[model samples]
Target: MRKNSFAIGCACFLVFALLRYPQAMLEAGAKSVTLWFQQVLPSLFPFMVACGLLLRMGAAEIVGEWLKPLMRPIFGLPGIAAFPFFLGIFSGYPMGAKITASLYEERKITLSQAEHILSFCNNPGPLFLVGTVGAAFFHAPFWGYIFLFCCFLGAIATGMLFRLFYFSKSVNDFIPYQKTPSPSITECLPQTIADSIDTITQIGGYIILFGVAVEAMKQTGIFHFLGNILSFLPFSEEFLCAMSGGILEMTNGTFLLSTAPDNLSFRLTAACMLVAFGGLSILCQTLGVLRNVPIKKSRYIAAKICNSLCSGMIFFAMAPFVEKYAQKTVPTIAFLAETAFTIPIFYIKSSIFFFACAFLFALYQRR
Candidate 1:
């Protein structure tokens, strides 16, 4: 029965792909496919290699230990879960999902903890916000970092809330920490680079496919059409667009938010919320990672709702101050403030960037 269901699902996907974008599929012959493969390889190669080094060096274990006390109180999760939890916050979205999946496979965490972690685990990494969204998209590093801070606060609040309500159980359920002996820097660095490359390469195809799909959707005016309809609703236009982009592809969605026309306050608020939520694209990947785990979608959905509510409230409360104080200040001052907020987060392993790197490393090292 499961085999038949899987076959049907694949068939449906192929049919949908063919029907929706026949031209792209047809023109996406050998050359286009090869080109896509080549384009994504370099970026993924370094990432994979880096992942390997982190694992071999036992960086993940070190970070996880560092994060145990903080995570235990806030999310009712064990020390081991911190690796993925932090990874999600620093690396963003699917990276967290990937790490969570790995932990589950390794029997390092229980299903309940996995589900709870997934709720607040999805986050946009600092690099994405500061480099891509801030520098490239918004052209304002200060505002970008401020928004990232807001999102982080929101994620923490949401995780705490979930811990208070649904996960009131004792921490005994958490797996006992097992220390992995670290390799020497000399040996570890080369291995890390190689592993990062391998993991990145395997996941590279998905990233490119997702990126192309987003581009194709943009070219087809899907976002515009949806934005037009959503604009009529109560929320801000930027919010609607951000939500749409998030549902399709998190990176593209964030990119779109950076380009949206509006006040910095409003744009920052919406972007923060989107980043906190980790977008629908990330959710899809999370589901894939959790497939073998005994996780429930309902619980995950509830956690997301909690996260959204917390993030939304934070964004609203911060908007006024950001506009009045931060906006009038020089960009340098603003950048410094934002950086101050982000610095502590960078060291904290629970952020999305760490999660992506750790998960990639874990996946690469899995026997």
Candidate 2:
């Protein structure tokens, strides 16, 4: 009852805010749409379609066969768990949750395995890290590489920590695994594209909604007030505001961080923290994907929080080596232009090629 009332009240407030500040809302929505088109769509769509196709084609299960030995020792999970983990690494957020949920629904992975994978599998993909953060925001792909490295280590650490303390000792208890239904490629391709479209559309909606909400807060000076409330912290008001934005929605937060004071370490650390945390928007997306599953929400949230902290610590530990080895200087405009132009093309072409190859492999195996 209380939750319902709070939700209703929040919705009312948002409606009022939208009416009160239509222009701000419009502008924010437009920016979010632009961001989605340029970055999110290009980076996520291909990979999502590919992932879906792979699952339907039974390719991931094939790969899982070989990974069982390694997966058991390190993560205390079945080899199939490797599919979501690596796919999440390559493809990015919510995909991990989606794949895990799909696995659970198919009764391929046990509930325990699903829950264990959920803790650390969902991650920011390399495209976003390298192209969006590295090339566009920081003008240096090097920072993106550093962030990815730290995030990967943090994910590993989180998984290991959970394996050590949280998961039960009896890891061998397995659900009788069922292989995914093998839909023909002709049938699978269209459905995979359709599902990917829906998923990307859902993501865009969240981005726009949160983008407008954040903008509304900023317009109303609520963001500034909130920042001031956190002035007691060691960081600056601008930094606090950026973090606040990030806490609600990661893309906007990182966008703000890019414009913050030119403190490399501070900016990188804050960006990494937000990326790892994945913001409230991402949480909603994750939940949306996993809603039907009986997974424990509290534990999932706790795992993400721990993962965020762990990533920050790992970044700090590796800061010295990264600083020494990686170049942080702003790149030339021509270079940025080159990177920006090529990345979307690369993502699209690569994903298509990857899926085509996988589809052929599956077809050949059937024959």
TM-score of 2: 0.86
* Model 2 / residue 117 / CA error / Å: 0.5
| Top candidate (TM-score) | 2
**TM-score, cand. 1 vs. native:** 0.68
Clash counts for all predictions: 23, 0
Worst 10 residues of 2 by lDDT: 334-343
Give candidate 2's total backbone clashes.
Answer: 0
Judged by whole-model lDDT over C-alpha atoms, candidate 1 comes out at 0.61
After superposition, the stretches of candidate 1 with alpha carbons farther than 4 Å from their true spots are 1-67, 165-170, 178-202, 215-224, 234-242, 324-367
lDDT digits (tens) for residues 1-367 of candidate 2? 8869988987887888899999888888998898788778987888888888888888877777656656666788877888999899888887898888877886778777888899999999887777677767877776777777788878988998888644574276655446656889998899889878987888888888888888877887887998899999887788889999899988778878888874778788889988998999999889888877888888988899889899988887777665755544555433123453222333356557855765565455446
TM-score (all chains, Cα) for each model = 0.68, 0.86
